[model samples]
Target: MKRKILLSALLLPAVMAFGQQYGGMWIPTELNEKEMKSLGMKISAKDIFNPDKASIKDAVVQFDGGCTAEVISPKGLLLTNHHCGYDNIQSHSTVENDLLTNGFWAKDMNGELPNPGVTVDFITDIKEVTAQILPGTENLTGAELTKKINENIEAYKKAQKTESYQTISVRSMYYGNKFYAYVIETFKDIRLVGAPPSAIGKYGSDTDNWVWPRHTGDFSMFRIYADKNNKPSEYSKDNIPYTPKHFLPISIKDKKEDDFTFVFGFPGRTTEYLPAIAVEKIMTETDPAMIAVRDVALKTLDEKMRVDPATKIKYASKYARVANYWKKWIGEVEGLKKSNAVEKKKQYEQTLISKNPAIKPTIDGLNQKYNEQAPYNLHKAYYSEVVRNSETLTLAGIYSNYIKAYEEGKMDAKNNEALKARLTEVYKDYDAELDAKVTAKILALYANKTPAQFLPKDFGMLKDANKNLGTIENMSKMSVITGRGNLNGIKTSDLNKLFENPKALVANLKKDPLVEMYGSFKSSYFETTDAKVTALQTDIDALQKKFMAQQMETDKDRKFFPDANSTLRVTYGQVKGSEPRDAVSYGYQTHLAGVMEKYVPGDYEFDVPKKLISLYNSKDYGVYKDKTGDVPVNFTATNHTTGGNSGSPALDAYGNLIGLNFDRQWEGTMSDINYDPKLCRNIMVDTKYILFVIDKYADSKWLLNEMKIVK
Candidate 1:
């Protein structure tokens, strides 16, 4: 015991130092002020987030409910990643006016295009509500405890004082150990301001998505409009550009290695506290299963996209969304094994048990529950991946929802019209033949990979000859949901005809082959898998919460940051490169010269715009050129980030905007589950490059006039 104590005393400082340097997605209201200051932060914690007055947090908003964007000008000009705004860009693109290919620059506010449903949510306030939310549930567990917690939350929200425009939401932290209430104000009248063409904004494309030494510009610009009183309102021509409380000043000062930087955003999710067994399951089983399914889908989509320009245009956003996680999972599995995360977790668990033997059973119980849940979890992954990737089946699932509503006697005129509108949007970019081909391949792979017990009955017939495309084609053609032999499948015109007779439509859908198959799969999932998984998860969560409390109590020297749950967070580090693997040290940044090095005139991923090449030839980089005599593009930093951190502001020590957070280094994708400071790095597009593209490339210097530039 004495020797262990001495060893812990010796190691605690190093552990704390490492934690302070590279780990943690901290809550802004509960920042570790001393540690942040020690790590070279020049501003107070309150300057980053102060509910009493406007601060840096006022400028940051959740972009389109997923990514993060920051107000870069007093007139509410927004900056975020290109891919984060890809869907809207695709929506506005057409063969005649291809905004995605040629890009768009609003010469004035009158030229800006409004996006009807898109919104940016500003976090007005975040306060701990644990006392109010968890007080009445101390003696309860499982379903009863959940019920009581819901009741308490409803009461707490109802009692709060908030403006009519502001909404209150509560989220649990540390596996329900604590809670926080957020007051959010959402602005709906966002409009596109400017974006570089894909060749520039998405330079390097999928080939360079998560890799370091990236040269992609990866950014887009937008403006937020509001009513005359500067309050949130729906889109209207009468609205005006919002006047922001605080907006970040763009820092054009030369950045170097070890410059203090921080990312502020709404990070989606991270499970940093999972036990060793869960990590092993993810690395060995679940990730590989989903990857295999997406692998088949991507290969099919790539073949179609490569040969057809229209298909490429139609599927660009869908393909990116699919390929994003497909590649991330591949990297995550590799990182987990290379980092030896499972073994390290085991060692840590042993140490934790040693410190407090009483908590050993809780840890053991959590592991046991994971082991039991493993097969069900994998089945869940396979089911979800197949449905998500197969457009036909996905559409069928939507029809299934309509069928449910009809059966429940709740299919009012409003619901019917809503369904028609949804189907129209879904079928707009959908290619039935392409979906059929993808469905055949992925369904075959699913049947071959999934256990017989978990598969639906339709899949059982294909199990013996899973690769037979003829049988799959026949099965799909039998379904009216696939348009009953129509190569284009259900058209919007067909929908109008189908909806003319609601009762007949419902009757036909009940007999549809694809819908039946979808129903069976969903039924099998809920009946055979979901119930058991939910029960085991309830017990596992209870034990895990206790385990978390125990670990925090026993390991008093270690800093405990809550896992990300799509709430606002602040993760800080420095501008630095990484040696992702042996003998392969990546530089801290990439330049336009490197972009030309990778350029191929006619290649989809590497094509350079003629104007961009002309500017490069003339060396017309303007003030955005770095001291190194090149235009800096993307840079790597040690900041921790995940999915929702895309488009987050990478701020300098003085809270000036330096870069836009976009992707993580490939080897660091596993940071969602386990972070290694040495390998984990967030990739950001340098603000210099953003300004260069906007000014020199697009010749849109008018947009730059609005921003406050700190030279």
Candidate 2:
């Protein structure tokens, strides 16, 4: 029997029979222009994307490989979330000139700070090539099918006409039912132009992160430079500012509740089409376990950071990165339960099965498969969190990479040069005591939770050592390369020699109890990554793709958008408030008064600069104030967004920049797995407020003058 291949949902109409307003992240080239026009979009599809002409797509970029940014000036002035630029800001910071704390501004173009290795990519074109990608694969299954698809994709990418600086890649949509090839022009000489103090940019900090009614400014400015011909190039003193094909005009016009809004950028990932059983497992087992582990790590780091400023600086980035998803997972669990997402998914599945009984077996098998794999998945999650969260273990893993290089006889000049660079990267912000405390606690939790069969045999040694996690932690730290106790005495040349001799290197590494233990765990973990389990997952993935195709076919008339996979997409909605629970509601937008209300002097999270307070007191918002005479800080909308959408541009009907995407409301974090129109909302910093800070607070008039402002 031949496998059934369903129609591609990317070609479906945007209008839904259920009258659901703008929820899907649409491909600009494949968008239903009529639906957009009917829904009050002022621009045509071509106006958003036109390879042969300058359009909105030309202005958007994937910032630093993780976030999104938009060019706002012909000189390549880019706008993105402050947190997205946090690492760059922190790198330029020092004890004396703490840019993270005090902020930095370039007085002129010549003052802009160049960042090494930072790059921004713009999509030049997107072409639907499902036919080409999936040709003659109807009879294949599992890895064979995947291998063919990848091979086809590689062939297609290689055949594309691209410049030396441009690149091509293929992305799967609708699970694997559809494929779109993208041509991207990437600029490498991105520079830091200006950023507000942490007090303003990261205002409210972790405590208020992912929560609504937010007052965080959460905006940063940068510039992209190119060679004289405006082509992408490596950073050079002779490079000139990139003159973009298109730049978003800053809108300081008043925006009210129900204002039409859209976010255009990359959204990292979303499993909007998962089975109910998977959602349950994530909520019940994975989320809670991961959250608990992170909770322990956060407590340790927070305690140290509060007492010591140096420790605070050392752990700030790591703490924020960990806490972000920790808080999001907590909210996701809450939202999933609050909205009864599992029950809803089951209902949808029933409807799907009813529409086509052919899918019933697939759906039933998926539920059983998810249930059986739940523990194994949770075990993997726990192990991942334990190793990744522990600085000592992370260092061990880093050294393990070098050991492999030595054993392979690949630790020559190039690899050694890279290893030296890696060492510098590792030890720069490392805190040994903090790592030891975090590692000890987290490893103990993992041992307590993980099943015995999954535990490495060498872990028995830890159990025999009086069940003392600290003992294991201390032994590792004292002997590992990153251990402060051992660090100062060990020279760089010593590490160089270790890499030169595989036998001596193994001997030296074996002397460290933690290293040896980690080696055992890694080896044992690899042993347990059963091929059968992998085959089961591969079967599940193939089933999922079929299920996705069936879903599109069953709901052919309804708008079926693909899930986010770190691809450029356009999601539009209205500025709206969410009633998370009965009798409690959040307004759509926050104001300067709210910032002042939350202000606490000398408090790490809530403190604002005195200059900001004075401006608020004087109502010095200039023309950026809303109709009510308050500067809008941040606003919420029904736009469907996820991780990589951070720093995406929030555009108005006319495609003018009004806000910068930074986060989603806490209750809406579940939007990734399940989207609820009432509860789901993305939070964005109002461009007016960004302008107010740049022009008034930061006194960045020159930067303001560079942007194209529209009232």
Q: Which of the numbered candidates is closest to the native, going by highest TM-score?
A: 1
Tens digits of per-residue lDDT for model 2, 1-711:
121211121222332122334367788887755666665678878889998999999999999999999999989999999999999998899999999999999999899998998999999988899999999788998778889999998888887788999999799899889999889898999999999999999998877888877889888889999999989999999999999999999999977666777899999988988888889999999999999899989998999998999899778778988998899999999999998999988998898888889989989889878777776778878888888888778778877877777778787888778877777776778776667778777877777787888888755444432355568656755674645434335543355554555576566676766677678777777677445457667767877888888888887667778888888999888777767766555677788888887888998888989999899888888898887788888888888899999999999989999999998999878989988777789999999999999999988898878889999
**Worst ten-residue run, lDDT, model 2?**
1-10
Candidate 1, residues 1-711, lDDT tens digits: the string is: 011111110121221224344478998998876776776789999999999999999999999989999999989999999999988887889999999899989898899889879999999889999999988798999889999999999999999898878999999999889899999999999999988899888887877778766789899999999999999999988999999999999998888767788999999899999889989999999999999999989999999998999999899878988998998999999899889999999998999888899888988798889999998998888888999999888889999999888889988889988988888877878887778788888877778888888887767666543455666567677766666544234434477777776777778778877788789878988877888888888888999899888888899878888999889999988777666666555667788888888888887778999998998999998898888788888888788899899999999989999999999988889999998877788999999999999999888889999999998
Q: How many backbone clashes are present in model 1?
A: 0
TM-score of model number 2: 0.89
> What TM-score, computed on C-alpha atoms, does each candidate reach?
0.90, 0.89
Residue pairs with colliding backbones in model 1 are none
Model 2 spans with C-alpha error above 4 angstroms: 1-22, 32-39, 90-98, 226-230, 233-240, 302-314, 420-434, 458-470, 473-505, 530-533
Q: Scored by Cα lDDT, where does model 1 land?
A: 0.86
Off by over 4 Å in 1: 1-22, 90-96, 226-240, 302-317, 425-437, 464-467, 484-493, 502-511
